[model samples]
Target: MKNSNLFKITLLFSAITLSISTANASKIDNDEFTSLQYLDKVTTDAFVEENKNKEFYDVIVGIEDDQLATALLTNDRMRKALEVGESFMYKGQEYVKTEHLLNVADQFRQDIKSMLGYDFHVVQTFNDIYQVLVTTDGSEEKEDVLKNLIQTGKFTYVQENEQMQLMGYDNEGDNKPMSVVNPSITNDRHYAEQVYFARQVDGYEGAASIEVAKQILSDRGVFASENKVNVHVLDGGMVPHEDLDYAEAVDFKYRNHQGKATDDGVIWVKKDFTREDDQYVSPAFDCSGFSSDPESENATSWRPDPPPEDEADEWYRYDTNKGLSLNSLHGLQAAGIIAAKSGNGVGISGIIPQENVNLVSALVVDKCSGGSADIMKAVYWSIDNLESPYAIGNSSYDGLPYERTQYPADVINMSFGGGNAMCFKRSNNYWTTAWTQVVQDADEKGTVLISSAGNETTTTFNVSPAGCENVMSVGAIYENGRPTGFTNFGDSIDVMAMGSKVWSTSGEVVDAGEFDVGYGPVNGTSFSGPIVAGLAGLLKLADDNLTPKQVVDLIKNGAKPLDVGFSGGETTCGWLGCGAGAVNFENSVRILLDGEILGEPKATHYLADHKQKDDSNYISLQSEFNPNLCSTYKVYGSVMNDKYEDLEYTLYGQVGSGDYEVVKVTNNSNFTFNKEHDNYQLSACNATTGNCSRNVNVELDSSYSPAACG
Candidate 1:
């Protein structure tokens, strides 16, 4: 067996050593409450030992008085600083010892046990702030302990930890089967002819054969990488489905980064604000161990409880006939839509072809609802620690968790969101419900964050991340191009996509222990969010240098403009937050590849009446300039391109029973098209390479003929 294999075997045995007891409360030592001397320990080995044993108390204390830091360093109440000197990688981030707790003025003169009756030790110190480990026999309630700490004037605030939750529903009662629409899925009564959105486009639907990469890159010569671009997927356990690439699934929570011969895997670290134990495999590692399945070989081994206690979390209400294991179902569905193995002759294709979008599980959702602290850790780990930096990040979680950590990913997809669900129990109000500031910081880092407009049928302006500026919020539409009643729409949403009953890879829930591999259709903005994320991947692949702003512009500009009835027709300021309409994958790619000039060429008829062109109004052929009664007409073309890049433009005109003639070439201004023309087309070509853009026929209104605007 391999060295890593040996580590796993050792881990297997080590796991058996730790377990979670169902004892009602924190274990209390029946012995008399005795305190250990804080000043007696100046050595690091004993400090490491006590941390591993969980014999220390972890607490975060913010000193209101700046001088308290100096005073605390001299005061002999808490353990002295370990003063780590070197920088090392932990969960993917470099924690420089030089930056760790440098500004300490004094140590607490009063022993925590003597004054507050709680044992305390320093896990980490940053300047005046100290993240201390708190420990006791377990007789006192955590609430009461925190209360006592807050009562002391020495500390500005008490410490508390938070976590994040998966946005999709969580239930185990009965997972009914959902409908799946796939061309390859046959011999099933439940199967139906899938109406794919690709077929709705002009060139895509009419194409006879299915040719990928070539069809996508369009003779660009470079074959799109068969390997998918990896992104961070922070959610519950990762179930290795046939559609999923098992090799890419990672559990950062239990990843062993230390070299060979080192057993670094730990059972579980309490969600406390402390570094009590850095060693897990050693006897010094503080872990409840194998009690739950977080350390199991199978990632999904730790499933959610059949019925969660928090009924307010409506993750249980939604289900379908497609028998999906409620355990980690939502994350799988969203991930599948984004990167499920495509065109293998078994399942439907993803927006970004086959396995070209690799998903790295951040594993934030531990069980049911995730804690805020883990989410922040996952984000930091993904952005800083991943072996391969992710190009995109997907968060299909709704409701609130905790913390406001920055996620500087290239592209982030938030499929899950709610209007406003604040936790009254938590001290943080709306901040606990969403990572609003994090998204803003991500935007600053050039991370294009795309989010669903929510399925609540309300305005998205109030939804977090979505509501946050710089986030491309998307609403959902049906196969027929009509806005779904469930999608939240407003002036804030940037674009729309097909979200109703989309088909993708999923885990078939069975009575047996594990889920069988299969495919199905799921509804809601959750699935729609991936469609946009997948599009972002395609855009990035086309132009590796595309920025978040540029990608948003292309995706939004390429959208097939739609009008939502519920929001009262199009607004004068442009379509409300609902945006340009349904997203056109072909158009989006075309914009990226061809630089946006597959647009219809427009013609302005210079009638004998001396008509002129103006922005207030316009005219076109068939309505203003008829072949039978034609006058001089000025033809204009449009193409999006970098101003610095040398480009040439040509206007093509076809007269009645005549072939198209090049009316003009490389003309920056309007061309006087004085001819009895029937139709017109525009072409943009690379000035030096002689390569020309695809021909674009101008679209003209029937009621209004081509005429010059007054």
Candidate 2:
């Protein structure tokens, strides 16, 4: 009996061992490797299904947790295994680390590739974060599979679409939930009182570019001393080691970087605010472009003129006569919006009343490729060198792919959007994810982000940067209280500001011309973003104790809604499209001071629902509530404030659904004083006197209601 039991036990043990071996072999050794192979397929499928009937521009994936980032960055064997440019498949995905960065990101990229796929591309290798660009195949099937892969436990977080991240607008599926910032808990809006602004000026190349902004800022009351807005405009590239050391040098609270300096220490016009004559100037440093030429009258005159060596301040041309001319207006436009002084009769006014701003400028655009590498370098420089208490930066240029590894400013302004991603055969999903990480990081760092809603009128699509959640997406409203015809509309738009036809400094345009008040006609959400930034600056000035979100909510809720359609019937939904309506500066200030909370408006009472007859005329509903029952009630459907005029409504009494009973009432009071009923069934009468003149009916609204008549 004992022998028989032993035999049975042995058999059972063998069976269990066999089952374990089979499962392990299938997972790690089998050629099919079905479990790992299906990951990419599942992710693709999930991505496709998740974005069904939806359009996007890119796909972005979040790096695994810190633990994973550490392992990937420190692994040497993985780096050794990677070939210069060879792409490899890991698990179900494919990835290839750039040969240039293999030493830094090889292990990280390899691990992610082995787990996610080889199609993943590394964005920033230094930081613990390993952002991989998951190529969006633009197929619904692929999208679904991608979604599933991200949802799986294998990867920590996956961003299926990059465009969604860029716009900051979150779909229901975005796993990341924004933490609501309670303004009540936080105090001191300007956390950092003392800060530094440093700029890298490529020696000899960008002399005029750096000086113009410095001089202009000086004129506006901001000087480059330790006591003032502490502006450090360096005229050299702080590269690899020096860059790292510079990061260690400053006790930073805030930073402003300008100009991209190449490794050769040459200044270039990678990106700079340009005047009308194409002159380039940096508020900080200016880098050299691909080509160098003496400032000439040629069409391709982007080359920077080499300055005299060792004469730093001598090269600085304080006179307006010498500014490099560049074609791009984005950077200059952004600066103007930030600190342009008003009443100059120049261009338009900036968000702040005074121009005392320390701009940490950097030229990050490559003259040859027009890429954003230089800009990334500027961000790195700011992170290391700046010492300000609160750092607020702005990026007026757009159309660049989102790079999550780049600098995360406390407040970054993005005003540009919309390119034919379809025409380029690019999915905007990846861009969205990168932008999401930006906003997420900003939240972590207690920063605020603002963006423009974009100016795509022909197509019904929200623009990038604005679509991302956690970002304040602003749309343009004309000075006349009308929504600009070009401002993009969607649920993602958060607020509206005066963007259309704003007047401000024209930079070199005004320099060449007689106009000191450089004003020009500018439109789009780009202008709108600066307006918000300016408001934010003012809010900080007022209280200096508000959280980012508190300031945002205060600005949003305090704003007054515009009458007519959002921006005067430009949107399909008009009034509805205007998010929280238009901004009201005075009201917002009042709200902040008083700390009052207004409840949501009560639902509109409709006697009947019907189509419209014309633009001005509309169907009327019978009085659902008797206003005359009491002394008075605020009819809060649509009340325009001092900034705008109130819309007049013609209250008509209809016998039923179809019959019309037009009534005329005085426009002064909410009660619609002295309105006469068309059917003579209801009439207008004096409350104090019994005098009646063909205007009386028991069924009519007494005074303005049926109860008043009774």
Candidate 3:
């Protein structure tokens, strides 16, 4: 009987060994699994060594399946992988959908206790992914704990949460507040100060092209406001400002400050104050706890504070600098550029002048710095929160109440970026995988992601999320259309826009009286990013069903060539260096709506020596006409001569294929001719040099107008 039992046990063991070999062979043959193995071989050891000594590490753990995560948490094998610790703390809200996991939550906790001897908590949870902040009081190294977690083969990847920087900068020696009033087509107070709203002398069509596109849409009876588009600006906190309209504003900063209170029941107010019960009453503070402060009884206000210098200074109740509050300046400026209130005779006009585009400020950055984990959380939240405009739902998740808009973001403007090299398929590191996943997920949800190409003025191949796939990277250009000295460039850039001296609503508070308001000029690719994001919002407003790829393609195809090359003096921007060129909102819109390119008007004239003249008396007569005023269009011709005075000239006009007709004859230096045809050509010539001005073609339609023709 014993011999028979031994033979049966041998057969059972052989069957188990065969099953294990088959599973390993299958995984090895799989391309994706093989790639993961290769990545593990190179990056695992280096990552563990690099982060071993930190006080604590916030690591993003990605799991291939939600079931696997639950199983790993309760698995006995996983509990034996590492030594148990004494104690630890986990913070942040967790969203989970598995009921079985909830039932086994105690088991999972016990398992964690046995594995790391620390309290394990889920900080935040994605669909099948989550983040955890690990701390241990035991002898085992934190990095070793992470290595053991990786060795368990339960997570898809694990990497430290990195940080990203805001991509804007103040011009060297030009940081003063903007005071110049340059007039634009709009009646807003600072409309003229927005240089991107008008064409530059160097032929760079600025964001002003959007105005023409708006007109075209209006003529077609397709108004932008009727089809509202939501744009989420993922940046620093947004203070209450007059110029910007927010669909929803969320403060993701840590809620650790203690509320200020007095014995008489006055609470500290961080926002604007109002009158109540015959007295000026401020909003109730939403803080952790109140402290009795008799000295602040009469002072029931809170001021904006500067960034902390160290960990000890991070927690504060009020402004210590007593200077301008730069808390939300970057975010406010970006929001202003995208969808500031327009035509209200307010501060300035946004790309979309009306209230059609909804702006959501996802405050992921603290002051000007933000971690990768928080950014990814905000992005995922935005994606999941996309719902019908009329459907009422709770949009708050992190203990903040934010109203649910018509939808999530049709386009997310990330005016911040960091890191070197493309984020995907380059290193296969944990951070790269997480970033790539977020960007890809956004794309899958039809949300176009746009980011600044950075201000490093070097190859953008090293900058991300700009270098990441599915992200439309933007570079900065001067008002004259040349690439900014500090704007990063390379194959990663999708387009360029006006970034130098661009004026928008500022977020600085000069004094306590001026609570949440200001306007000024700032420089950097940071501003350039929102300009394109505004354009994307308009594109979605024009056609709510357009895919993210289509929107990017249309923008690229409609872009105009830059005034200069990426390196300067090169005539045009190369495809890999400066993208498809400068963004032309009008042309992009026209191409989408009309399926054709309506070229802008052009006229060229130069002085040349004539054989019959001894003193080079070349007369060049240039005519200027307003193409926007249809039916009452008039061309005013002016003559310039080297020697001749009051030169006589004749203006000729041809309608379609008709013969040239004398539209005007004058001996004076200036003459005017009324346009009488929808399509016509005009030229001016004098008998002196027998030279004629270059012919200018004027095309007028209900939706096609160039504003000016020369």
What residue runs in model 1 are displaced by over 4 Å at the alpha carbon?
Answer: 1-196, 201-214, 222-228, 252-326, 385-410, 418-437, 440-447, 509-513, 564-576, 598-639, 643-683, 686-710
> What TM-score does prediction 2 earn?
0.44
Model 3: CA > 4 A from native: 1-54, 65-68, 71-121, 135-152, 175-183, 200-208, 255-326, 385-406, 420-422, 426-432, 510-516, 563-576, 597-710
What is residue 113's positional error in candidate 3, in angstroms? 10
Which residue pairs in candidate 3 collide? 84-116, 84-117, 85-116, 85-117, 182-192, 389-406, 420-462, 421-462
Preferred candidate (TM-score higher): 1 or 2 = 1
Highest-TM-score candidate = 3
lDDT of each: 0.47, 0.35, 0.56
Residue 261 shift from truth in candidate 3, angstroms:
17
- Cα RMSD (angstroms) for every candidate in the order listed: 14.8, 21.1, 19.7
lDDT of 2 by residue, 1-710 (tens): 12221211011110110001111111233333333222221222222223223322222344445444432331112332334444443222344544444434445445544654433433223222232334323343544645655654445445322211111111213222222111211122211110000111211110112122233333433333222121111111111110011111110000111111122222322223343464644332232211111221121212234445653322332111111222223434554555544344333333444433343323222111121222222333333321111001211111111122233333445554433221111253322343444445555554556667766652223444456566677876644455666767666767777665443333232221111223344555666676666556555545444567776787777555543443454433254376766665544543443222232322111221123312122221222344432222222222211111221223345544556565544332133223322332222222222222232222232223223223
When summed lDDT is taken over every stretch of 10 residues in candidate 3, the lowest stretch is 11-20
> Could you give candidate 1's per-residue lDDT for residues 1-710 as a string of tens digits?
22221111111211122122223223323231112232222322223233333323234455556545432331111223223343333223333333223323213534455786554544333223344445544455555666777666656556433223333422212334423233443332222323443334421221111223226564663334453444555554466676666323333222211000112222212221222364222112122232223322222222223334553222232111111223356667777766666546566555554535546554444333333333433444444421211111211111111122233345656555534421111453212222443454455555667777777677777665466567788777666566666777887778777676666676554311135667767777766777777777776666657777778877776666555343665532144456766666666665555444744655554442344332224334433545433455554433354532556667777887688888776534245554545777777766554555787785432233333422
Q: Taking the tens digit of each residue's C-alpha lDDT, what string does model 3 give over 277-377?
A: 64534533322111111122212233223234552222234421111222446788888898888887879888875558777877665343666666776
